[model samples]
Target: MKNYRLERLSSQPIIQTADVQPFIEGYDVLGAFNPAACQFGDEILLLLRVAEAPKAEKGYIAIPIIEEQDGVPTLVVKKFKEPDGDYDPRVVTIDGKVYLTSISYLRIARSRDGVNFTIDAKPFLFPTRMDESYGVEDARITYLDGKYWITYTAVSEHGPGVGLAVTTDFVSVERVGMVLPPPNKDVALFPEKINGNYVLLHRPMVSDIGKPSVWLAESEDGIHWGNHRFLFGGRGLVDTKFEWEGGKIGAGPEPILTDEGWLVCYHGADPTHAYSLALALLDKNDPSIILDRSEAPLLTPELPWEREGFFPNVVFSNGWVRRPDGTIWVYYGAADSGVGLAKLIQE
Candidate 1:
């Protein structure tokens, strides 16, 4: 049987708390969760995952988010228990010290060695008047047809959704608005158009929606997406108690068009939220159709550091890079703590 290896790429996190302070809060700093790395004009850019805690008052909960005015990326101090309160995660105090229960927002940074990074002066993509009232998280970037397409999570009091944004120079962002409806996240777009149409993989979570399974969706102009169908659902296994998806799974990075098929890296979590990375070979002509998938995990939380952190037992990804020679570089978040990488072998 062929086995997939999870080798350590970098010891230092690409986007760490030490570097991302003052611009954002540290109490709940966990950037680079779904970092999107790509080579542009001779340099590699990493889209980091940045989270912040709500500022605390005497007894009020100061929610931290990207203010929705001028889109300049600022913090707001709001009471926690508002009638239309946020619903991404909860931030409640236990005894005395404050903690970040749920901090959601989009953070960006650039890198040279794919390890050392410099955060933007301000947030690259923040909350707007759209579904981001709750917050933004997990961005997957793809460069296609002379433009960059960004697929991200739009969180609100209602639920989590997917949003799209386009850019050319990577400095000025043109928001295409929320593409996916509600209760959906972890979207990965095919690096290029499939059959003259945009192909994307997304997962919509519903307690009654037959578990958090992966789904397929297609777009025409890369903005509005629809025509949902099942790409692949979790299977019942002897070791996994014959259960489908534990919690969720979706495409990790932009799909790489390979000789065999499109190499898709995704994440699968059980009911415990312990995430592990996996692979699924997709048909190049029609990526929505799954060709083959791994029965076992390609990369799981086996290390001490990966087994413990803000959220223990987690190894999630949203981006990767594939060289011309078929060499692959995958970057992921460790226990929702920092960014890590591994190699992809398709021999």
Candidate 2:
């Protein structure tokens, strides 16, 4: 691990809340973070998750409007008085129904140096179907078979699930529908087929049965997935005993293929909800087999920006790009408010 050097690209947030405009007017916050990174024609591209919410007034919180038309639905700006229920920055509970405090969508940002990015004015992906009435978020991009495969988290009344889309040119995207059902997210597909089948890593939340953990599934055509196998990170697992990751864990950037094995970067949280980044290595031939895992976190929230924001003490990543010079650039969300870049170079 000493051979790997980590460098913070900037002290300030790379993509800030003021950089984007909300889709629905009157929304007060612009949280653009948790981007998916990839290389597109000598340029680094990021698909960022942008969240917007109205300022909480007096004793009320604003909830996005879910407009349904011809059985399809879309999210609009709306507000409801805070009822007799629990409320948090991310979600609100009233009358036994849960509502998200903010609505999310995906937007694009391009960069030549990976540190400096120019974000597009409009969103790239928004809620258009009933299943995504809440929003789309945390996209992981993998270029496979000459097309960029995007797997994202879709939230709605139905629940959170994994949705797929394909794009050759970011100008237009083709939706591939929901490939994984509710209580699942954090999906990343392998850049190439493994043993003639597409491999995917996801985290399924089964609250009553067990804590959320990473799992692997196989698909023949990148749509239908099956043959689920538990990979790592759950209560009572030997590898999860570390205090920072004992509560929950999920896959981060798409696994980097190395001569040693498949290098995976993942995020983990403790009971206190402090998130940190960790690394693991899986067998190349059989990704299900764990090769090596870091006993301590690779990165933690120590900076002021990473220790405060929409969600405090969280540093989550959905993407990274490895340069030809053995330099790995990790683009991540710091405190769920802004995007930050970290450089890892092999010594």
Worst 10 residues of 1 by lDDT: 80-89
Residue 336 of model 2 has an lDDT of: 84
Clashes of each: 2, 0
Candidate 2: C-alpha RMSD after superposition: 2.0
Position 13, candidate 2: lDDT: 81
Residue-by-residue lDDT tens digits, candidate 1, 1-347: 14445566766455545567645544445444668777766566777777666444554556554456676545565454432445334444434433344456566667666556777767787676546865778899898889889888887655788888888888899988888888898888877877788888888887853766778777798777778888876664335742324566666887878777887888887767778888888887877668888877878887766777667788888878765465777888877667777777644
Q: How far off is residue 45 in model 2, in Å? A: 0.9
Candidate 2 lDDT (Cα, whole model)? 0.85
Regions of model 1 farther than 4 Å from truth: 1-4, 24-32, 55-60, 65-75, 80-102, 237-245
Question: Could you tell me the lDDT of residue 235 within candidate 2?
Answer: 41
Top lDDT hit? 2
